[model samples]
Target: MERLQKVIAKAGIASRRKAEELILQGKVKVNGKVCTTLGTQVSSKDIISVDDKIIEKEELVYYLLNKPRKYVCTVKDEHKRNKVVDLIECKERIFPVGRLDYDSTGMLILTNDGDFAQMLSHPKFQIPKSYRVTVKGILDKNDLIKLQNGLVLDDGYKTMPAKVSMTSYDNTSNRCVLEMTINEGRNRQVRRMIEAVGKIVSKLHRMQYGCVKDDNLAIGSYRRLRPHEIKTLKKMANEGISE
Candidate 1:
């Protein structure tokens, strides 16, 4: 037996937090009766429904997608714009682990396992993500050092220390490419960090997430997670930064 919200989340109906909201709204029913209590438990034999529609657990599926720029990382877009899930031809309903800005692109993980998604998305997990960023102005060693030491964003939130290295620079264009590795997932963080340092971002691409990398996967393409990859992710999620 498990909490109703947990079961609903595991079935991919919604995240655990969203499932709780559904229960609070009197939309979830267990064994044909409305269940609004937070800690209600249910077993496999119990029937679950939301708004009179029955839901069942889906077989878990994991996918690694090389997201292309201009694609939104969401299950549904109000503007009817193309979403990352639409790019994949999978039968199971899988949502992105977190988010990548519509203008930025690269490695993204999609999965039906809500628990796994929660683990990866949670800040406490401190999952490392790396990005290759191009900016309009050249960044010097001091700038890189400042980034490594952390900075205060325009929003006044102090960014955690990040690993920044100069990849290359073009004198003719007055542009530079740098790589950054950070464990915190902030909104437009890399761009904001560069902006805080008096540079403007021109292009951004995520290159890695936790132990996963682009691995030569073509942009706009996706592949199944290998058994070993899934194992490693589970271990990382469980052990966190200690691993």
Candidate 2:
């Protein structure tokens, strides 16, 4: 069972807020009766209709894409630049669970499951995401410890403590490569965190999301998520596991 508004939103009938408005306006009917309350639990067998039209729920599908740089993560881009959704051929409408900046690349999940997306996105869940980052300046142990302890960003929001590990520092190229696993999802967060330490991010790529990794997937390639993988991710998110 799922929330009525979320189910309607996942069905592509309308946004969740719009679905709730329809429900409050008495335009949504469940099993032949109007349901105005939000958070109404509904099963697959429930007959749902909106504005007197029956809603057809799309089959829930999940895909893990090894996102390539230059492609936007949005379902539709107004500028018509490349979108990640175009990389996959699916009948059901799916959207990226979280966003990677236009230049950032790595493991990204796309799904039609609104609840699953919301669960992973909620900060309270603290879904662990790992990234490979290359920066301009070498960070010493104290700087890395600052990152591990948390740093205040430009916007005045302090980041949560992150798991940091040094990959390599090339003296010839003056670049520092490191792996950071953070559970919070903020806009351009990893970049901002590096900047907080007076370093500029030259490259950023996600290596893992929850237990899902980009091991065998090639750049711009995607595959349907296995049932067990999906189950494990859901479990991790619910349990706030940061591995």
- Candidate number of the best TM-score: 1
Worst 10 residues of 2 by lDDT: 10-19
lDDT of 2 by residue, 1-243 (tens): 999999888886555666788899999999999999999999999999999888887888999999999999887789999999999999887888889999999999998877788788888899999999999989999889999999999999999999998899989999999999999999999999999988999999999999899588999999999999999999998898776
Model 1 whole-model lDDT (C-alpha atoms): 0.89
TM-scores, one per candidate: 0.95, 0.87
Clashes of 2: 0
Model 2, residue pairs in steric clash: none
Scored by lDDT, the top model is 2
Which residue runs of candidate 2 sit more than 4 Å off their true CA positions? Answer: 9-37, 40-54
